[model samples]
Target chain A: MKILQVEGLTKVYGKGDAQVKALDNVSFSVEKGEFIAVVGASGSGKSTLMHLIGGVDRPTTGKVQVDGKDIFTMNESNLAIFRRRNIGLIYQFYNLIPTLTAEENISLPYLLDRRRPNPEKLLEILGLLALTDRRTHLPGQLSGGQQQRVSIGRALINDPAVILADEPTGNLDSRKSRSIMELFKMFNRQYNQTLLIITHDEKIALQADRILTLEDGRILRDEAVRA
Target chain B: MWLSKRALETLSQNIRRIVDGESVDLLDNREGPLSILRNDIQTLVRMKQEQADALRHDKERLKDSLSDISHQLKTPLTSMMVMADLLETAPPEKHAELVRNLQTGLTRTQWLTDALLKMAKLDADAVAFNVRKADAREIVARALEPLNILLEMKGQDVRTAGEAELTCDVRWTAEALGNVIKNASEHSPAGKPILIACGENPIAAWISVTDSGEGLKPGQIARLFRRFQGDGTAGYGIGLPLAQTILRGQNGDIEVDGSGLPPHVAELTDEEYSGATFTLKLYR
Candidate 1:
């Protein structure tokens, strides 16, 4: 099933003279369990496109339907709840709560919903990420590689449908970056999680199941990887 | 010419090092030229400052570029996370694990982006507070409220004393106290007593969470709030730093007395020594 659909998406900021087109008439669809990468230069509207699809920002003209629901149609309060329950977002700096341990960070989504975290499932992900031993430590204590793993666990805590990562390995060294990508692969293979990542690094982008290139607020290319 | 002269001076210093313990000094001329050389050294320092100023400007520009790149990556990653999360709730079976992983991965990325953003914001001096009069005891309760279940689950208890009312930002103060209490709850074992006391001293309003956990060794006391510094754990090492940030933002502070004050723990049970106690102070 098509998990995400974006049609005629255009995002414009400011008015007439000062206005900038962040995304212009962009359209795309993503399949379930696909690891996709959106690549673009600094000025490209790729990030803007990602924001529109994520429901973090509304497009000036277009529709983005995730699970067949128009997110922009919802109110801000509902959107916050929806985003928390459905989305898992990761970034380069590993935004685990500074005070929360690995376990707490992983369980944050569920905790937000006022539910007890599933220890069994949490332990499983912690072990997979090799963070079981460091479960009690704060984000400040973990190595870059370990901290990223905790972030992965936090995203997984909700068991959300899709994971959106932007330059998840940007801060790590090559070794740590590779290991993080490997973990992404492990998740794709083991759990069949749908992933859409934004990356500047060519190697990182190439590893995606599909590549979508954006330039000057437009989609330049979108293609699946060959076996 | 000036650059060349400085280079020559540096060359002579290297040559002096090579002179095998001889009484060699750059300005030690037999003509009593030390005073003149000192004046020249002062002039060189002034010249170097001008050059260093230019380098500082370049460094700031590079730092700005990196910050921009980080934001560029972060903005989209956040959106993608929302999209992935929305998609995760789709079909029940076809790509369950894939969906789970995507959501998880996205969350991880989002967190990292948040830290970078916070760091950038801190660097940019964008983290300002709206400090006001508030209650200290109430703030502690509010921060501890979320973790009440966890405390209960661990068979732990918390008590408070002193007037709850004081002056500070309710949210920021709560956040600081939350960190201290949460740290105590997580590090110490179950069925132990964790005490949170709030009172006003002559200097500042004090709030302290004393846990009956293994006390910190002399080593852990130092480098306590350093970022990414932890005792082999999964955290990003930002709690104490963040607490410090929040407290400091409110013109308050946090400290640790791995050897905390007495009465706070004199009658404590044996299980309470596994972790250390932390105290926070804020202005009235």
Candidate 2:
């Protein structure tokens, strides 16, 4: 089944004299549980595509359907709720609140939605992230790897329709980066999680099941690593 | 204005570009015979591009293997030379162990060369596989014939379950399966039983080997089949690539399922399999 679809996706920036087409008629559908890596050089519109898909930003002309619901059609508040409930976003910089402990940071999503995370699932996430002992430690007090783990925990706390990460391990050392990738891979396999990672790192991209090469806002190639 | 009714000159130029080995960015609107003609032309260009890519890939692989083969051979050769010097100078009493060391080095070199040569043949399309329907048990038994001593040395165990009669080049299939089994044995803890299961599904007949070690780490599965591209966590060999080639030559392939949690493990855990499971799928 198709989990996400981008149809005639186009994004334009600035106006007439300084205008640039960030994305150009891009269209693709992601199957359920697919782990895809979008790779491209800088200014390839990778971030624009991701932002549009995450529903954080709207395209100038396009349609994004998340699990069959057209996100652009929804109002801003409804879109925010839908995004929080269905889309999980992870960034290169560990986006944890300074005052929030590891546990609190992970629980932020739930707090925002006026919901309570299941205690058992929370415990499982902490334990899985190897942050059981560091649960109360603030992001500032933890190492880069630990901080990233907390972010991962936050992403999974909701069990969203799909997980979208941009340069997720680009901030860590090789060893730490590998451990983070392992966590992502593990979740993908056990739960059949739908994952889309935007990375400039070829090694990281190769780990995915398919690679989509974007150049100048266009999908240059779509290759299956394992079909 | 109909989308497909674009100027005749533009369509001719686009078709001309495809014929001249250039990729034409396809617009998302087309219908009828014009679409079919355009598609076929695009396919031809794609295939041409793919063939060129395949050629470059093969060249890169050749370079990698050349370096790998030399590196592998140099170790034993250098060691043997050192041993030869020690034997000439050392007394006869020490000469015994010296000779034994030299012999070991020779055996390793021989094995490495032999395997590399076989792989080269596979690469060159020199090996003509004899495809036939064969007993799964018989092939499994044959594959294990050479590994018995290694397994016995480590006190390892093998358990066979289920069975399937698959169409394949039995000896080559056995050879390929054996290499995979060998890898599993290396990963598995000593005395742990490696389960071999054979069965046929609607798509293909398969023989799967499940080892008792922690499954592959992140990023390992993708490179597992590449020649000499071992997962950094474990020492792998050219055997996997060879197995892959042999199977592919006969319309078969190898797949690995390294989901950390085993099938029965419902809870969250990072344990990869009981270990990793490798399955050799032979198309029916």
Candidate 3:
């Protein structure tokens, strides 16, 4: 299914003199479970494009729809609920709640809803993260590698239709970076999770199922990675 | 009189070198008596200051490490002793009980060591921040890979959308995303779905991880960014804070969105789930 659609999205900042065209007539569509990598120079408006699609910010012009609903049309309150219920976001930083343990961080989405946490399943996640022993530890206590795993757990906790990550491995070492990439590949293949990431590392970018190159607020190239 | 005259000349030359901002080689062996005296004195003073500074920094570091180590060891040691005490008193027929106690103790010790290691690394500046550009989805996938089996076992599925390419630290972000996703997958009900999505706006791009588990309390959300502070039963309190650090370090943020009538698993289609949603907002 076509999970997300963007049409004629244009975002402009400031007025005539100080005006900057961050996104100029950008449009794209994503299927339900495709891995996408967006590669761009420092100021290509690639980040802007991501913000518009995720409803973090509204576009100066154009339409954005997730699962066929126009996100722009939703009110602020509705958008908040919709975003929480529909999207999974990840960052270079783990963003796991520092005060929350690994398990609590993963379960936060559910906790926000006042629902009972599923115990057995949480154990399984801890096992997968090799965090069973570290479950009670704080984020400040875990290694960069382990902390990132907890963040991933938090993202997966919600199981949204789309997974978006920005510079996910920007702070780890090369070995850890490769390990993380391997994990992403494993999830994409095993769970068929649709992933969209923004990065500048060539090695990381080439690992994606699809690559979109951006420069100066435009799509420079789009290609599919060979299996 | 001749010796005094030579000493005065040497002192004046040494002072001139110091004022000129030139490095004076103490061993230059300038036979001039005054130059030799001044060089010797200057070298001795410089060496003494260097030693003093080194000693000071080292002492400070040692003191901090000792305190941190003691603090770190306290909880684990206490837990271990309690568990051990319980096991020692348990009846011989309670084999399962003994085993449980031992396991809990071991787990606590392990947790303490892991925390200490990270703390040490951070303190020593052992963690390197090598930023770069790469695919955000690739990072997410990498983060999610280890959690695949967990999701499948829980009878839950994780999904993603769009091309998620970004410029930042791949290792850091992947770790962050992985932690968040893993948390959601673990807490939410089995057979439920967790969704991950990415898209762009004019100012920045966003990657969101949403789960269909219980939502957060208003009080918890207010202080969610603080360290080691979860009201939930299973929280280690490190995951979200680490994630926040990683994000903030990269000029990004992790925000929680809990609106009226928190969405539930029942409300989510195979398309949506009732869990937490975390957004990683990236700027240009």
What are the models' TM-scores?
Answer: 0.44, 0.56, 0.45
Candidate 1 segments exceeding 4 Å error: B1-284
- How would you order the candidates by DockQ, starting with the best? 2, 3, 1
The predicted structure with the larger lDDT, 1 or 2, is 2
| Superposition-based RMSD of candidate 1 using all C-alpha atoms, in angstroms | 28.6
Q: What lDDT does each candidate get? A: 0.69, 0.79, 0.69
Scored by DockQ, the top model is 2
| Superior by TM-score: candidate 1 or candidate 2 | 2
Tell me the TM-score of model 2: 0.56
What is the DockQ score, from 0 to 1, of model 3? 0.01
In the range B169-209, model 3's lDDT, one tens digit per residue, is 88778877877787677668888877777765333455777
Give the higher-TM-score candidate: 2 or 3.
2
DockQ of each: 0.01, 0.04, 0.01
Question: lDDT score of model 3?
Answer: 0.69
The complex in candidate 2 yields a DockQ of 0.04
lDDT of 2 by residue, B70-99 (tens): 887887799899999998899989998999
